[model samples]
Target chain A: MVPTSYYIILSAALFAIGVLGVLIRRNALVVFMSVELMLNAANLVLVAFARERLSIDGQVLVFFVITVAAAEVAVGLALLVAIFRTKHTTDVDEVSTLRG
Target chain B: MESLQIPPVDLRLLTPLLIVVGWASALLLIDVFFVPNGRKKITGYLAMAGLAVAGLAGIPLWNVSGSTFSGMLVLDRYSLALTWIFLIAGALSIAVALDYLPRHEIEQGEYYPLIMFAVGGMILMAQSADLITLFLGIELLSITLYILTGFAYPRVASEEAGIKYLVLGAFAAGFFVYGIALIFGATGTTSLAGIADYLSRQPFAPQDETLFLVGASLVLIGFGFKIALVPFHMWTPDVYEGSPTPVAAFMSVGTKGAALAALLRVTLAMEAARDFWLPLLAVLAAATMIIGNLGALGQSNLKRMLAYSSIGHAGYILLGIMVAAERGAEAFLFYMLAYTLTNLGAFGVLIALEQRGEAAWSIDDFAGLYQRRPMLAVAMALFMFSLAGVPPTAGFMGKFFVFTAAYAGGLGWLVLIGVITSAIAAYYYLRVVVKMFMQEPVRDVRPELTRGLNTEILIAGVATLILGLLPTPIVLLVEQSLVALGG
Candidate 1:
């Protein structure tokens, strides 16, 4: 079995990848996927911590987080689809109508 | 190990939230069953009635004080006062929504329910004393807002705003949850009071210091995004301009107020680490003031202008938070009240004028509003002045107290920045006023505001003036509530 530190390291790596995607990706869909990656990374850390600490509250919290994240993704993807249909592009650069 | 039971529910303590949720559900049912023919007025009335009843119910909870549900939520004057603010803002938004939604042909039955649920979430947030409850409350509020932001689903701009807000909002929430996990790991608990006690007992150690500071910083980032402080505020203008006007107004006030209140609670309860968080908040306060004001200089759209202006206003409120003194919270509370009333009033007028179409939302569209409808022109003038922080209006008093609190807190330089921004803001704010009163009537105008809308505008106008002039009583009430929070 792997050490708890291994899980922590994995979570950190995933979180960094998520941040990089958010910063580097111009496509709105990819950026959104990166955000979901970050949330899942957080959940991994939470579950790892729950195991290390021997508590169910942390696990319970992960459940709630998943629920909210699903709702968020649903709404977000719907908006993205609508935007793509109108602007004919999912690139963030093309969606700058309100810029000064 | 004993399983943790669901915390005991307190019916009396939760009456305000229940009222809002109940009314929201009722409105949804009414819209679903009776309003299939697109009768939007009934939904508005039902939403207003729910908020009014909730506002009335909140009155009795004003002086009460205690922790409920095993210390997860607190019932005190601080939360109650904010409950009333959220309810009144909700009601006013609903009223304005009645006029705005139908004109745009985007009336949806789900709008009122989502708004009430959002208000309920905000109330829960204000009352939360534990990290878990706080997270839950924020999610509830944010998810509802996500839907409301894109309710005009087919509108490209609306959908874009909704997506942008969702991505950024979820990013922030991720930071918040990770922060909570770190705090729990470091302190072995998720309760705010528990963390405070744990931190107090621990001797100073380098590793412990890093853990606490990193944890706190993450949490601060989470809230900074919500309040739209400079670095995290990139989403503000797009979301504000793209969403329906009433939703934008509700979010600009309700979300900020709840987030600020929760930030205060956590910071004050964990006062042991003031050295770490306070300076960071101070820098944010200054930067947000400069960035928001400078950004607003050339915006021709009314919604985008208010969005940036509200960002600057958030900085002023943050100055009050920097003080972290007794009077600081009171000043913060008073400023929030003043800002809410003034902003809703401005949006109320915008929603009223929007009856013709989105074309009326431009600053140039207001040319010779004085000639079109004298009363609305006067009301808009007062709102603009108040927003600009001019004296003899609520906005002025709100700024006075916030700056005074910051000065008392030794944030005098930040206050100086605030004053400078206020001056810069006056230029843009007065441009609208000039367009209204000075320019020629470019197009033939018709007063399209209904009786309900006119009444809302009048109430907002009177409330702004009254709060500005006779602020002492309200100030005292907020102070009493802040003191109660401390106890």
Candidate 2:
């Protein structure tokens, strides 16, 4: 059986990579995918903890997270579409009309 | 197989929340089926009526308190008081949107229902006793706001604002979920009461300490982004400037107030770890006040200025939460109400000055307003003074209460920082007043004072003054509304 520490370390690394992606990535779509990656990392942690503790609450929370993430994606993609319609680009750099 | 058993649910405890969500859901259908194009103002009026009904529903539950849904949600005076405030803010947003939407040619019936849904999310946040519910509430509010932020169709800036807000908001949610997961791992539970129980138990396992503290800090970061603290406030000015003015007004007050309410509960639940979080929050409060005020100084746009000012006010309210377990809840509630009225009123004036083709939001737009429109100038001047925490205004009373509370809570240094930064903040807020009263008009611009906008400004203005002058009644009510965790 895998140790809980191993899962925690793996999840933490995934989360760190996700954060770096969000920071370094210029494309809105990629940045959003990175957010999904971060959320999945959290889900992995939750499932690991649930298995370690022999409880179902953490696993249940994973379902909620996944559901909410779906809703987020729907809105996020729609927003992207809205922006794309006007600018014809999803590059974060090009959407600088609001800068001071 | 054994038969499944459900926990006895208490429907009565959710009367106010149910009214809001149910009414909003119904309004969506009613809007599509009945309300026609160019008559979306009917939908706005209906939304206001729903909020009024919800507020009335809460009055009967004022003295009642309990947890329902197997302790997922609790209805206490804390949630009740916040319910009234959220409802009022919702109604006022709808009121302002009624005219502004038609004028901007963005009159969509969906806007009113969406605001109601957002209000429902806020009430849920305040009533949540478990992390799961809180997470849902935050997402509900965020998702609704993302749509509303981009409601201004075909405007590239508005859509850009929507995407920016979504990206940043989702980033924060990532942090929030990870924090909750770590917290659950540390304590094997997601319920606030359960976590408190674990924390207060004997021997206090040292292995869990690091996990819990890290998790708590991450959660604070999530909220920091939402409330626009210094390091996490990057999206605020752009988003406020890009979104529609009425939506900006609603987000400025509604989101911050709801997040603060939830934060109060979270901090109070973890009171066993006060030594860990108290100083951390104090430093944050101090930084937020200084940087938020400083940020506002250079802003030329009215929305951006109020965005920064709202951040500063969040900092002051944070001081109240720091000492809430002992003596800060009343101050927090009062400050929330006071700031709500004043900030909304300030934005209402901006809405009045806003034009169709060109958003007359520059500070210079207010120049010589007293000569052209005395009543509008007076209202704007009053709002500015209130925001600057001047004498005999709600903002002043709010600052006084929070500073006194912080001082009593042994946070004298934070109180001192608040005072100095407030003095600095006064310059910017008063800058608007100076422009309105003294300087000559930069351009010949006419402010549209529609009936809806006029009524909103009047209600907010009159309430701000009354609360400032005679604070005793509301103060007593807020004192009585102290959060009782034992519900």
Candidate 3:
């Protein structure tokens, strides 16, 4: 049987990678994908804790989180498509019309 | 296990929300059936009328306090006061939007309904006591705002602003949900009161500290994005500058008000976690003040300047939260009211000056505004002074109370920094006033001010002045409401 600490550490590492990708990547699509990765990492930890504690609430919450995440992704992807159509680029740096 | 009985829905407790939603659906239906071609000016009036009725309905429920919907929502003075604010903001935004939308040629009949839906979500958010309800309320507000931000579809900047807000807002929502899950897992409950009870009793184990901190930090980050606090305010200037002026104005007040209400409730109720969140909040508040004010100094566009100015104002209001006093809550309420009136008045003038089918958004556009329209020039001056914290104005009084609360709470350094930033903010604000009064009018520089009703302008101008001159009654009302919160 795997130790709970191992799962926790793995999830933490995954979350860190997601954070790094978000901060370092200039492509908006990649940034968004990184955000999804971070969220999934969180969900993994949540499921792990739920299984470890034998509680239903944590799992129930994960369901809601997944639902909201899916909705968010839909809106976000629609926005990306819209932006790409206009500016013709997905690079975050090029979308700087309002920058000070 | 015995079956749990669900309580009947209390219409009185949910009157404000129901009224807003009912009006929203009614407006949608009106758009669908009666006004297919979208020549629906009356829909704006109807929306305003509905919000006014809801505002009136909220008056009687000010003193009523209770939880409903299986403890998911709480109807109390805090939410009631904010409901009135949101309703008034909705009415004002619709009034402004009515004239501004037609001129821009983006006259969708659904615009008014969307505003109502957003305000409805805000009302729900203000009253939410459970995490599920809070998330739902935020989504309702955010999704509508996302569409509204980019209503001028096909415009590149508008599309960019909309996409930025949608993506970042969704990311923040993820953080909010994950935070809720972790918090619920640790406490065995999702109700704020339940979490507070559990945290108060449990000893702080080092192994669990990381989870607790991460959970609370995620929730704070969610609100930080919404309120546009430092490190999380990257989307604000672009969104505010790109969106229609009225939508930006509505968002400046509506989103901040709801987010602050939630922040106050969660932090105050979660008594065991003060040591964790307070210092982080203080640092953010300080950084937000410095960065926001400094960012405003170089901006030439009037709307972008005000956007940064609003960010700075958020920092000032966050000072109230940092203090965490009963007086702090009172100060926060007073500051929000003052901010709502003053910002609406400022945007009212901006909307009045905006030329048809052109973005008259720059500072130079306002040169010699006094010569062009003396009443508007005076209105803008009043708004600028109020925003800069000039004495005898509501803004000054609000800032004074916030600073006083901070000082009383032993955050004197923060208060001092606040004073310095207010001074820095005064410079940019006065520069606009100077351009209005002193600069020569450029050739062929005409702005459209005829579309707005004389009555609306007069109302905005007088409200700004009166609120400035005598803010005692409103201050006392805020005090009373905070007391009712049992803070």
Candidate 4:
């Protein structure tokens, strides 16, 4: 059987990559995808931990995360479209009508 | 295999929450089918009615205290008090929006229902006793707010603010989920009480302790963004400046108060690890107060200034939460109520002055307010005074209580920083007052005052002064409502 430590390590790497993507990407869509990736990484952690403990609660929480991620994507994409219609771009830097 | 036995469901415990979510759902359908395009105010009124009904439902359950859904949700006076605060904030927001939406040509029947759902989410956050429920509650609140922020669909800035909030909020949510997973990995349970039980039986493997501490920090980071602490508050000014006035008003008080309420519970549940978090949070609180106040000093836009001010206010509220185990909860509740009324009234005045155009919300717009509209000027001055911690106003009393509580909890430095930042904050707040009362009208701007807007400002302004002068009754009420955290 695979060790939970290895799973945690892989998920941690994936989470870090997601955070990096969010920070480095200028396109709003890619940044949003990075957020989804981070959430999935967390889901990976949950499943691995649940399996290690033989507990169903952690696994159940994964479903909730997925459902929420979907809802988030729905809203995120809608907002992107709305911004695109007005600003004609999804580049986060371009959407800077509000600033100090 | 034996039949699976479900945990005993306590429907009565969830009466208020159910009423809010249920009414919001039904109202969504009703708005779509029955409401006409131009008559969206009916939906707003109906939404207020639902919130009122839900508030009334909580009155009967004031003395009731227990958990339902297998200990996922709690019903206690603490939750009940927070519920009424959220409801009042929601209703006031709806009232402020009643005329502003149509006036700005962004009136949508869906607006009111979304606000109710947001309130429901806040209530859920306050009632949650488990990490999973807290995650759901936060998401629910975030999603609704994202939509509300973008509700001004034709406005480019609104769309931008909405997307920015979504990205940042989702980023925070990701951290929250990862934190919960780590905690569960370490303790084998997600329940607050279960976590406390796990921690109480200490002497854990060092690996587990590291995981628990990391997880706790991650959770705090997630909440830090929600409550607009210093480093995490980048989105606040832009978001508030872009969103509709009423929605911004709601987010300022509603989101901050709810998130802090939940944070208090989380911190209390982890009381066994006080040495680990106490200093960390204290430093964050100090930075939040200092930086937030300094940030507000430079903003000329009323909404942006208020946003920064809200961040500073969150710092003050954090002082109460840091000492919540001792006497901070009472202070926390009082500060929330005072901040709610005071901030909402300030924003309500902003909504009154707003006109249909992109270049609105300049500080100069407040010039000659006294000469043009004496009543509006006076109300704005009152709110400014209250927010600046002037005596005989709610904000002053709130600051006093929180400072005293922090002092008692041996956090003297935090209280001092709070006072100093407040002194700095008074400059900007008083700038508005001075402009309103003294300056000549820079732009001959005619405020579009409606009955609903007037009522919002009146309710909030009067309540702020009343709570400031006679805080005894509410203080007693808050003290009694501090139920024992089963965790």
Give stretches of model 2 more than 4 Å off. Answer: A88-96, B483-487
Task: Spell out the clash pairs found in candidate 1.
Answer: none
> Model 1 compared with the native: what TM-score?
0.95
Clashing pairs in 2: none
lDDT of 2 by residue, B1-487 (tens): 9998999999999898899999999999999999999989999999999999999989988889999998999999989999999999999998889988888898899999999999999999999999999989999998999999998865678888899999999999999999999999999999988988888884567767888888999899888888877688889988998899999999999999999999999998898888989888888898899989999999888889999999899899999999885568888899999999988888999998898888889999999988888898998888888888997989889988998999999999999999999899999988899999999999888989999989999999998899889999999888788746532
Model 3 chain B poorest ten-residue lDDT run: B447-456
Worst 10 residues of 1 chain B by lDDT: B352-361
Clashing pairs in 4: none
For model 4 the local lDDT of residue A64 reads 97
TM-score to native of every candidate shown: 0.95, 0.98, 0.93, 0.98
| Tens-digit lDDT string for candidate 1 (B1-487) | 9997887777788889988988788778878888765786777787888888888888888767788888888888988998888888888888878767777888877788788999999999998999889999998999899888887645667877787888889889988887887676566678888888877885756655665677678889999999999899989999998888899999999999899988988888778777778889999989999999888888888889899999999999988776757478888899999999999989888877765444466787788999988889999999999999998999999999999988888888998999999999999999989999999976665658887778778988998999999998998888888776661
Each prediction's Cα lDDT score? 0.85, 0.90, 0.83, 0.93
Query: Candidate 3: lDDT over CA atoms?
Result: 0.83
Query: B345-455, model 4: which lDDT tens digit per residue?
Result: 999989989988644599999999999889999999999999999989999999999999999999999999999999999999999998988888999789878999999
Against the true structure, what is model 3's DockQ?
Answer: 0.44
Share of true Cα-Cα contacts across chains kept by each model = 0.49, 0.85, 0.44, 0.83
Scored by DockQ, the top model is 2
